[model samples]
Target: MKKIFAILMTVSITYFASSQSKTFPIASTLTTIDGETINSNTFKHDGPIIIDFWATYCKPCIIKYNTLKDKYAEWQKRTGVKIISISIDPASRVESAKKFVEAFEWPYEMYFDLDSELISKLNNGSKVVPLTLIYDKDFNLVHKSTGASVLYEGSAKKGVKHLYSGKKEITDFTVDLSKYFEIIDQIISK
Candidate 1:
């Protein structure tokens, strides 16, 4: 009886200990355009993260995101990968960010580095628009680059596909359609 009880206790303890997920240090606290503070520290680390840095006035940024926004959800489901769009636009442009989201009708979460400190720390003092930073489940840097799309390999979707599929054969990052989502409409329809 004593032996059985001891073994059961050990198994129970180990199961509980292993089940808790470890949180990552992506964003401590992010402010929303509606004046709300959301701590991104609780992101579900089930998979890697795709962080895109952008600004409202950036034409290229808009174009890149236009491509990104359409396929955000499909990517989330296909691989459990998620995107955290961080806006570099000024605080004054906070409203613009929110308006832009509304106009485009996107469902992904949006944010801005109002203090600009997050961008500096994450990218090592290099402030650039449309920067995509990929991190592993353990909070390790996978890929970092400044461009309209994550061109480390072929395109942004390729980066996402590579991360989820675990096809290490490809040394470059690209975004493939089957592993991503896409937007179909831009003009306000009748």
Candidate 2:
């Protein structure tokens, strides 16, 4: 009986700790494009936030950014969702990362993880580009996905053409962002 009670108590404690770990990491430090230092709390109150991790060298990251560039404005207007793009580049590439952002003129809030400290805290030091995390109004993590947006791609004969199934090359792909958008919509509606 004593052993069973002890095991149950241990399980309860572990469950509580894991559940509580979903909150945004207040200790995380990130640098703005202009070199201003900021922490996770800086945006905690502004929930329904999307934190997108990227690097200067990640092609999928650039593709993802370009794919969402135009929709960002509409998303903000519709859901009041705030997107924060953070560069996970090493310290040496910080300048290049800034230049890349400038050249693209990305409109969302931008920052850099010089030492990847924020990335480590939020992503368990995974350091993978194109990692996206969505936090709720209360700053609890609601969703997380790694890699670029899901792309629907297929191949077929040259003569195959249709309204919803047309193709120019052997393989055509389209970014699927509805999943993220739906999650954001749900988060705000809650």
Global CA lDDT of candidate 1, please?
0.63
TM-score of each: 0.68, 0.72
Q: Which regions in candidate 2 have their CA more than 4 angstroms from the true location?
A: 1-24, 150-174
Kindly list the per-residue Cα lDDT of model 1 for residues 94-121, writing each as its tens digit: 8888887787676666777787767887
Clashes of 2: 0
Top of the candidates by TM-score: 2
lDDT of each residue in 47-131, candidate 2, tens digit only: 5888899998875676567667779898888888888899988778999988877776788788888888887777786888788
Instruction: Give, for candidate 1, the lowest lDDT window spanning 10 residues.
Output: 181-190
> What lDDT is reached at residue 162 by model 1?
46
RMSD of 1: 11.9
Name the lDDT value of residue 189 in candidate 1.
17
